[model samples]
Target chain A: MTVTKGDVERLIDASIGAAPAPTMDQVKEFVTKTLDYNFAMTLTEPFYIKPNAEILHAAGKKLCTVISYPLGSYTHEAKLAQLKQALADGADECDIAMDVSAFKSGQYDKVKEDLKPCVELMGDKVCKLLYFASLLTEDEQKRAIEMAIDLGFPMLKTNPGFGFSTTVDQVKLAHDFAGDKIGIMVSGGVRTKDDAIAFVEAGVSRIATSAAFQIMADFDK
Target chain B: MNKKELAKYIDQTDLTPGEPYDKITEFCKDAAENGFASVCILPTLVKTAAAALKGTDTKVCTVVSFPLGMDYPEIKEIETKEAIENGAEEIDMVMNVGALKGGDYDIVNDELARVSKACHDKGVLLKLIIETTLLTDEQIVKACELAEANGVDIVKTSTGFKKMLPRSTSVEDVQLIRAHIKPETGLKAAGGIRTTEDALKMIEAGATRIGASSGKDIVDGLAE
Candidate 1:
């Protein structure tokens, strides 16, 4: 099926992370071009463009800043501080990377505790939890989804674009685990319109990528 | 440098994606036994590495804005503080190479100063990774100068994450950094120093620290 512009726009979350810091002109260009779609800037180095959040928000764009991206290894306090800074800078959403290491070490409580503060801090703003699905076992991925759901996160994301791309099976697994209780966002390697459509067919609510503009442009053809 | 001496200069690292907890523990154990200078790990693993190396001289070193130096100065400061609280004795932060290349040296210097102050406040050594593989020689020299001026304790060569030029750690880069910095400033050669010969060449080129994942192999190769 040909993906519609509305469908692509609704499902796209243009992300800027895993690269060097873009200049202000680049940020402005991105904001202007992808105004119709959601934008996420990872809270890692380079994209800490919290200062530009106000401009993006004024443009009626939904700007999100991801915390402890690619590696949710920050201490609870650090993550909270990052979330607060992002919020103060005008971010409408906070996408937190789940403490996968803590979970893998069987420190489930620590993992939950790590997320609790950010969830509380976000308040009315949207909170999405990123679980590096490709790195976790099937059971672990399911449990992560459950925890995010229980925490009342608005969305659950797969991968931080650092590891493997989001697969159809992974998206389906998340959909099965979440069952519409929470939005499912698939990130990393959704490079084309076809890939995006396949994910949408798999029940993905959103797709986060650095290639959103390219994908959207490709879809118009 | 001999194997024993080389061990003292090594900051054994494993910043691999999806690195297991047990592997970090194992890295710490190996570092301690080998008399390595430090165990370089992710910020979250600092506490674990600290606990593992308790009473041992193997300091816990972690990265800030690691692999990519693009986070705001405030966020990097928070990361540095949290890392220190978790028992990180050394902080290896990637300098905002984008900012440097963009000619925003003020922002770059301010970031280094902020993180450096945080580390110095807790007596933690700070190493700034310049990602030399992605920079020209002039940019590399400028980065080292800025790092020294900003009070960074060590000037690191790369984060080992560069894929473009991918030169890793080289003797010429180490020599350039050593020549630019003060005598008191430390030079750390990281990225691709995978053999004993590479380690010795770095040391000979004036690197006081060598960051390598192949610490065991390099040391073993020394025996041969």
Candidate 2:
């Protein structure tokens, strides 16, 4: 398995486009640079999606926006609305935060009910169920992964990466449980090229990081 | 302010996503026992917090379009209504700060009016979090104007989760916002409010409420 820098780039999902408090000029500059780098996907919030969709499309990069991000506590209706709005705003893919609070509270039905419509709405679009595997107990993580699998999400992401770190073990857990039924994407704890390559080897479909460019640079060596 | 009075101004918040259930239950119990104004939590835990604080004076408050108010007004409205049904007595929603910063006042106003109406219809109070740390003095004033104009129950300073540096809500910010908004519009100072001293400064600066995760620490500091 010879993983080249180009291979790594193709699997990278860079979030630099969504950097905080960027002026429109700064956003354009950053997004242009990210698109030029040819990362498989560039993630931004819904507000920035419409403005940059043309450039993203021109550069042949996928636009990934978040729905109920970081906190999956939004009601089912709100999440669906967010999903619809994100797509309407020119999102090619979405990383939706799952209702970890409900699942952890032992409200499995509530969790499933909340996500069903969003998944259905996403249809063929890439819908990654973003859950905080690092914050949950091992059993809870397993249950969460299983629930995502049961719900038929196209992809599953581990943690949202603001002080929450994900491990290869978590990715492995999802990879094993999902068993080709769904793709696994890991966001947190990926700081360097080695970490990114390792996660991909461990069975991740994508590696999301603010360190995408640095990882790409490191991969050049 | 005395400990009792100060406690009433605090909305004990744990809006951290995926916070453990045991932690939330304990948080609810502590907030109830301490008699804080409300236990502010994520939407999923609204029902749990409501159940925990059922017999107590503390209410269950939840956030909508939180930390980032990027959703459409219709979406935030539905979220507010659902949160009320789940037992959230107060709703601290983040206005579309991006729109405000981008000078799209119409989107911001529409969101505020719709969410405010949704909450008021259910006798729930709406606290509009404008994320003051991300805005300029003018933007803050404009945000207050919009919040006040839409009949928002309260104008909150920040979500405390700004992606950039200096995430705290300064006393000056509260004062500036308070000066701009009407006296009838309640003011809440959230984000980076920790110690009892910080709470008192915000209160003196005309803040009617304090949104803090360290509600126990602030009250206990006063007791000590």
Candidate 3:
């Protein structure tokens, strides 16, 4: 296989994922090494926005979080409360799960109805609809993508690391169906450079993974 | 007479709990007397609101999940039934943004299908709120697509939560949906839409209905 420097570079970029908010020393080292990347950090218990803002600004990267995380089964009040906290913390965007159980049962209307309130609750914030399409078939994915587009999601993402890896065929499936209607984000198991560049080439607008640093590190080396 | 033309819009909130007895009845009466288009009430008080405003131009609207749009299909179906039974004229339901984000497309489809069926089965209209502020521009478009695909009667903006109301229903949100959905579908803009300028903006942006805690203010502002 002809592995050129560019291939390795893309691999490094895609590999950039999770990092323990290192001491100022480690952070300075990483920034000195790599520049082009999307870095992420989840809100640890008891989120404090100001400190995170300072930390992220120093790292020169955007911040994101999940609300009513894992499952979107929380009461409206509870989910809103979580979102309020995320926004107050200066999160660049949020990954909110659309209560999946209701959607699976073919209760389109009930699911349909909630779009507005959820969006309202997300007011003036970046809300990315986490499209965990792993459990769904291609056609089913299309329908889901259609509904998500109809509801007005800012970003349509796949996999939150809860299931199967984010694959090429799947990304292609979403990209094909989504067309220009929405932006596609691929998360879950994106730990190497080969995949990240391929995903970008495949029309993925963003890549969410914990390997952001390695992707960056591999570049410097 | 055209309902939309006969009178101006009114929100007639439904979050109020328990026996609306004196509360909703009196409120509906005042609205009807003032020539408002509708009295929106909780599904529980649809009958009461409708009854109180009997013989007037005012209509009745109810919400499926008042503040949040996350619930099982079975429960939402029942809520739809109850709201229709109680004489609701329109139904505003929240979409499962979490499910969509989670990539559970089937779940999102099934959930909305159930509620939309309930509303359509009873001839009551359905308004799907994407809650624009919560969604990214792309996600917003996808949400609109889903609402249109499921046969929802309208695609609305915001449920009174979101960072900043998108300068009145966001012509972009409206135009995006307008580009796809059949002409039968409509658009609604809620949240921070109080001033006449706000109302006009939504109208221009393609919102057919405007949901506001400031409905009275919007109407009065329009008069001004």
Candidate 4:
């Protein structure tokens, strides 16, 4: 069965990371072209910092910025500053990476503290915490998901597209842990429409990918 | 150079994506033990590295706008400030390659100046990664000129994420950058200096700093 346009749009977080920095024109092209198919534009901090958030918002696009990006190891203060700047730049959503190192070191308090400020600052805007699921053990992952739930985060993302590909098992783990309270976003290696469908079938609420355009095109076929 | 001497020029790096805290801790430990100049990591790890290397001479260095330096000037400046506040002693930022290549020197110069000032205000050194692998020799020279003119502390060669170009750091590129930069300004060779011999050749070609993930191995090779 072919995926509906609404289904593609609802489940896709169009990303522009891993590639070289795109020019303003390129970002415009991306924003304009994917306006119909993408749920939001997940841009790297720099690209998000460019003065296009207003335009994207005008075009009815949700501007999402990655905080501390692929490595969620920033000090609380640094991440706070980044969140504030992105918000000031008109970002409607914040996809932050949890401090993976702190989490791994069993410094859950530090990790919680690191994420707290962004959630507080984001206020009503969408705030999705990236857990980098492959880096964490089952218990750690569960604890992280529980913390995110406690923190009132509406979404929990897996992988930052840097480490291991976001597997269905990991998505299922998040799904099993979160159930319906937290929306799951699976990123990293969901490059094709089939991958996106597999993830959606596995119970992921969203798919973060740099190849959203290609995936949507493939779905049309 | 001997192992001890070579250590002074190394900025032990682990900018690997998704690097864990334990690994960063280990990298900092190795850097301090090896007498390396600094431990270069993603900006997120600056505080951890600073804490790990406290009381040591090794500095805490973090990347700004990172492997791809296309962020707005305001963002880079903010990132530099945040890094310094988090205990980063040095900032290695990528120049806007598209702007530089497009001959938008004004945009490039302006961004560098803003970030350079942020680093200088904190007494933190700033390195501009030109990503030599992606540029023409002429573009490289222009970039070096802009970097030196803007008072960047060092001009770095690559971010080690060779996407569209070869990732190697050539001695000739170092010489070319060294040729354009002032004597006081340093040159850092990164991206592909994987061996002791490669590091030495870069140093011989006038690189004052070496950014490498293979710091331990390179230092180990120096012993033999």
Q: Interface RMSD values for the candidates, listed in order?
A: 2.9, 2.5, 16.3, 3.4
- Residues B51-145, candidate 3: write the lDDT tens digits: 89878877787776544454445555666677677677888887765555545567567868998898888788888776666566777777877
DockQ for every model comes to 0.41, 0.53, 0.02, 0.33
Q: Candidates ranked by TM-score, best first?
A: 1, 2, 4, 3
Clashing pairs in 1: A45-B70, A45-B71, A46-B70, A46-B71
The regions of model 1 sitting more than 4 angstroms off are A17-19, A36-47, B17-20, B162-167
- Summarize candidate 1's per-residue lDDT along A74-140 as a digit string, tens digits: 6677777777877777777777988777788878788898898889898998888998898899999
Higher DockQ: candidate 1 or 4? Answer: 1
Best by lDDT: 2
Full-model lDDT for every candidate: 0.80, 0.83, 0.62, 0.81
Question: iRMS of candidate 3, one decimal?
Answer: 16.3
Clashing pairs in 4: A73-B44
- Tens digits of per-residue lDDT, candidate 2, A26-133, equal 556667879668687888776678777778887777789888887777777777877888888789989988888777777789888888888888878888888888
Ranked by lDDT from best down, the candidates are 2, 4, 1, 3
How high is the lDDT of residue A66 in model 3?
66
User: Which portions of model 4 show Cα errors greater than 4 Å?
Assistant: A1-6, A36-51, B17-23, B98-107, B162-166
Minimal lDDT window, size 10, model 3 chain B: B161-170
lDDT of 4 by residue, B33-68 (tens): 999999999876777798899999999999987666
Worst 10 residues of 1 chain B by lDDT: B161-170
Q: Deviation in angstroms for A142 in model 3?
A: 54
Better structure of 2 and 4 per lDDT = 2
